[model samples]
Target: MLMTERRAVVTGGCKGIGAAIATRLEADGLSVVRADLPAAAGAWRAGGGTAVDVDVSDTRSVDAMIAAAVGLLGGLDVMVNNAGVAEQRARVDAMPDSDWDRVISVNLGGAFRCTRAAFDHLRASGHGAVVSLSSTWGLGGVPGYAAYCASKAGIIGLTRAMAADGGPFNIRVNAVSPGYVANDMGGSLDGLDAEAAARAWAGRDLQASFQPLGRQCDVAEIAAAVSFLVSDQASFVTGTVLPVDGGQSNRLNTGEQQWPAP
Candidate 1:
């Protein structure tokens, strides 16, 4: 069947990497639904795509959102679990329970909820695919981001597990682990003052120096990676975490190196 006949859902799809993924999927001829937080509904400026508000952390919200999306699209073929959050830097001992819980609930739990709610729709589609967003921190732990790291890492494990379960139904499940991306969540200083913005760029420069690519990733690049995984090109691929990081996953940080804020 033509990709134009397929349907997709991208959580947190109003901005950043999620927006990029949604756009790429739509460009590839898939009918896309951009699901995000209720407050972010107005942030979707793109046309020709359905936008839905969903708090992935809430079971009722996720279930209802999936129902609505399926009702709009008639069925679901791809599920992109991209809604996630990161808390500020803090030592594990100093990290508040609220921070840990919220991050896990939104990041890890959100992915699970979305996938579960959409599993049936995807299975019914006969050729289903799931792509979740992980992070470089999920692969190599970073200082002061225990909750974020753990949640992302859990995504990898969940992706593999889901892949195994979906194998019998021709459903593929995978993850994309992105390193530093030039986005608002990745330290972009869009609203920051001159000094803060400079500092942010300086930090990116320093990190880029250590990274083999000598630069951060573009949201479009990450979107492309996801695009392939959900397409027929990766029909044989499943249960893998594709690192969209610029070889950052291969580079090792020295124990004494100063780390970025979480």
Candidate 2:
């Protein structure tokens, strides 16, 4: 039987940006299988969607995840590499080897594993697409995010290289680079109380001086970019990193800029 509907797998899809992406894709009529860690999977209430368990950092786990998704969804058309982690901010001099390895294994290696595992399936779909999550920090640098920045920057490199490889197979690969988003992962606000989190969020707003949009991005906004890249609307697009960073990536944030009155 010909499956007319598209099928997708979203890593780290149980919550935050991944969840938003899964929900958005579902709304677009794709059958989505949300994959998170085994621990987090226990808490997933997929509602009308499907959920699975896999640790992106583990190759065996990632392979099992792809197999499970194929079994449940019948096939895969889109792969959203959104699973990642961030630890306490520390300067490079103080960063531990364990922290760097953990972040790289999950954030960068996970994307590579997932994409590679799904390569054959995507080729068979004849319209396979991949949208990975990068960050504005990936484009440049942050003082205390050595491992994180390296991992995300690696995603951009991986995206472009894989796009080239997938092109011959009719599989499009791209990435979305987002700016400061108020999420449990990116902003170091996971364990803070409401008041403290609010203050932290407020502090990040200083980017408004250089950011055109003048604020942080919502998860849904980032998901929208993922949605477009996966859809036929972007059939011709590949090997590109789309910035969902409110124009933050367009200019260097050297310091406060003085603009003439318009």
Q: All candidates' TM-scores?
A: 0.92, 0.93
Model 1 residue 183 lDDT? 81
- Candidate 1 lDDT trough over 10 residues, lowest sum: 41-50
**Model 2, position 252: C-alpha lDDT score:** 65
In lDDT terms, which candidate is top?
1
Off by over 4 Å in 2: 1-4, 46-49, 257-262
Candidate 2 colliding pairs: none
Against the true structure, candidate 2 has what lDDT? Answer: 0.89
lDDT of prediction 1: 0.90
lDDT of 2 by residue, 1-262 (tens): 1223999999999889998998889889889999998766667853544788999998999999999999999999999999999756899999999999999999999999999999999999999999999998898888999999999999999999999999999999999999877566643676789999888767777664468777788889998999999999898999999999888988766687647458
